[model samples]
Each structure stands twice: as structure tokens, then as C-alpha cells.
Target: MKRRTTERKMTDKERKFLVELLACTPSKFKRWMEGAQNALVLWAASMLGMVLGWLILAWLIHLLVNLEVGMRSPYALGVVSLLAPVCGLYAICSSVQWVRNWPDPSEALRQDISGGKVLDETYNVIEAKRFKEPEHGGLIYFLRMDDDRVLVIYDHESIALEMEGENALSSSFEPRRELHIVRAPSTEYILEQEFSGEKLELSAPVDLTVPPDQWPEQESWCEIPWLELERRLGMPGF
Candidate 1:
């Protein structure tokens, strides 16, 4: 594999554009942490509510029927034990469904970009490179958004400027449409795609900040215009 040196550093405008884009998107780890935290909270609350409901039901049954009812009673123990599996099953199913229905990480970013919420330029671009492989090449951007955050962007050339439902309804579908960006820590070398909220681990993590001579493989490294990047990202014309 021929090793091609990086063409050039990002221009000021290009850096600003990247920074704005990064600002609009959350990192992959952060998103996962948030989802886990939410699920834990939900589970805890549900379990607590179930316990209280069980106690209330037991009390009502004893008051209405004049039966001896206590947590240690055989009847209460039997009922609670039976309900345990049902509650566990319900929690497991609920979590699975919630995860399956979770939206792609880029969904919110796309919405923010379309809604003009990407104007907040909080992140600074540390480094950026645009390159393509020899075969089946499309534009790929490796951007260092900060000291720790790195973004690997796959720009689908085929749908660079295509609009939704432009062609016939049946032929309008495109696999992995528009842009897919993977955000990871600078220390991480493996690339992951959060497609439909599922992490699909791809290639090893690439640290692009190193000299091009030390890069893993040689490819056509070049610069992309800010406007062109915007078009590829499905952003409206400025």
C-alpha cells in the first residue's frame, strides 16, 4: 500500500465549520453513558413502585377478606415469588424494546444542523484530514475536535447532493444515506458507527495527528472545500 502524505492543513473557515458541527453532536461514549443512566433510573423506579403496589394489594386483600397477611406469610411469599419473574421479564423486555427503538446518534445532529442550532461554535478544531481509498473511494474526514475527541466522518459521494425521495419511490432508498460520523476518544483507535443506536465496530482507531509518513496506509489525501463538505452533509446552500 502506497503511503500518501497529508495534502494540507485545514483552512480557517474549514476549521470553524468543523467546530460548529462537533458542537452540535455528542460523543459516542457520552451518549451511551446517558442511555445507561436513564435505564438504571427507570428500572429502579419501576421496581420500587412494584414493591409498594404489592404491599398495598396484600393489605387490601387481608382487610377485605379477614385473612392473616404479612410479609412472612406463606401466601404472601408465594405471591411475591411468582411476581418476581414477571417483573424481571417485563423490565428486560422494556429495556430491549427501548434500545431497539433508540434513534441514531446523528439524528439529533442532523436536526440541529437543519434547525440552525449548529451556530454555537464551542469546540475548536485541533486537526483535520480529508482522504480516500484507492478502490470504492469516497471522501473520509478525520477530524480532531479537541484534546480527546476525534471524529471520523464518512461522506457518501453517491448521495452528496441528493435530496430525499428525489427518484422513484422504490428506487429512492439509499443504504447508509448522507453522512455518518463516529466520535471517539483520541486514545481509541477502533472506529465505531452508531447506526440506529447500535454500535458497529469497524476499523481500528486511527490517530491522524501523527505525521502522514507514519500513517497506517497510503491513500489519496486531499483538502475539501467547506461548501462541498456542507453539500455532502446535506446542509442547505449558504
Candidate 2:
């Protein structure tokens, strides 16, 4: 006999939140690097093997033919010397790309938690509209409180929020996406939230510490083009 399992459907609010989260896309560098990550690794390995194979073949050619004569000829030596560095450089590049594309530990954990139900503690009730740029294809929740700092949050597959100049917090929202914390940003030191899995991980790095109190008050901040912000921050564009 097989065990029976009952699955409940998500409520309307949950479904809407999920749709928004699913629409957000990762940075361009991530897309490019992850596109052929596995294939790139194999290519790098094959190229290294080819280099070793060529070295062995050169030795055999020297033994079987007038290899000393070829080595003595400046033209033959020049061709060999030129090709060696080119092949070496290509191999080095491919290897670096493979490592750079490796998955982040924090991101991997977030994906895992997405399978479970989102805890009730995630939602923040304030109606303050954070940066809402429909053209950018996403909206971020920006907030300011008692302290001289700002809180920026957004919903992806997981809940990603950061306190400028402080630390970031990311949690899986299997059932819902919300910010439950009410405390304002700290003025003296950075505040952080730690999970059993790993620290906060984001597509782009941000320094909330500098000008930590500069929270966007007017809707004008939303008007600033998304690509422009990405460019200014030295982050990958769409």
C-alpha cells in the first residue's frame, strides 16, 4: 500500500506574492556564467589533456624524425613558441570561468528552504511604498525608522532585506513573503541576522554603512532608471 499525502493550494495573497517573486531575474553575470558552467569545466579539462598529449607527441616526433634539425631551425622553433602561450592562456581562462560560476552556499540553502512553508513571521505591515518601478520589472520595499539608517527589502523566491551600513537578511518564503521586524536601523553598530545555513548573499555588494541615513523619501528615486543604478554601483545590467 502507498501512503497518501494531501497538499493544500496557496491562498490568493500567497499566489500573488509568488508570481511577483518568480518574475524577478538574477544579474547578467550570473546568467552568463551559469549558462554553460558544466560544459565549460569539461572543455577546460579536455584542453589541459590536449596540452599534455601534444607534449608527448612532440617527443615522439623528435625521436622518429629529424627532430634536432627542426629544433635547430629558427622558424620551426618560433611557431612552437607562439602556439604554446596561446594554448596556455586559453586553458587558464576557461579554468577561471568555471570556478567563478560556482554556486554560492547561501543561495543554495535559500533554494532548499523554499521547499518548506514560509513562516508567519516574515511580513511587514507598514503601507509605505518603497521604490516601485514597474518598468524595471520589480519593486523593492524601502523603509526608514527611528534610527539614522534605512531598511531595504524585496521578495524573490526568498525574502532578501538589508539595513544600509549594517548586514542583510534572507529567508525562504515558501508560504508568504514579508518583513516582521519593527526595529529601526542602528546608529552605532551594524545589526545582522544569522541563519543556521550561511550569511546573507546578494547578486551585488552594497555598503549600507556610508550615508546610512539616506533613505529615499520622494518617488523620484523610483524614477531613476534601474540600469543607471546598476551602472553606478558597478553591478551587471539587464
Best by TM-score: 1
Best by lDDT: 1
lDDT of 1 by residue, 1-238 (tens): 1111222333454345544655766666666666666666666677677778878877897899966665757777777676666666666667666656664446444443344321211233444544442223233455544433444454454233223423121232122211232222221112223222222222322222333443332112224333343334322211
Clashing pairs in 1: 2-218, 3-218, 189-204, 189-205, 190-205
**Cα TM-score per model:** 0.34, 0.26
Residues 98-192 of candidate 2: C-alpha lDDT, one tens digit per residue: 55664333343334235332322123222222232322222344332223123444433222223222222233421111233211111111112
lDDT (0 to 1) per candidate: 0.43, 0.37
Could you tell me the lDDT of residue 164 within candidate 1?
Answer: 42
Query: What are the per-model numbers of colliding residue pairs?
Result: 5, 9
* Segments in model 1 whose C-alpha atoms lie over 4 Å from true places: 1-20, 27-29, 105-238
Clashing pairs for model 2 are 118-175, 122-178, 122-179, 123-178, 123-179, 124-179, 164-208, 165-208, 165-209
lDDT of 1: 0.43
Please report, as a residue range, the 10-residue window in candidate 1 with the lowest summed lDDT: 183-192
lDDT of 2 at 25: 41
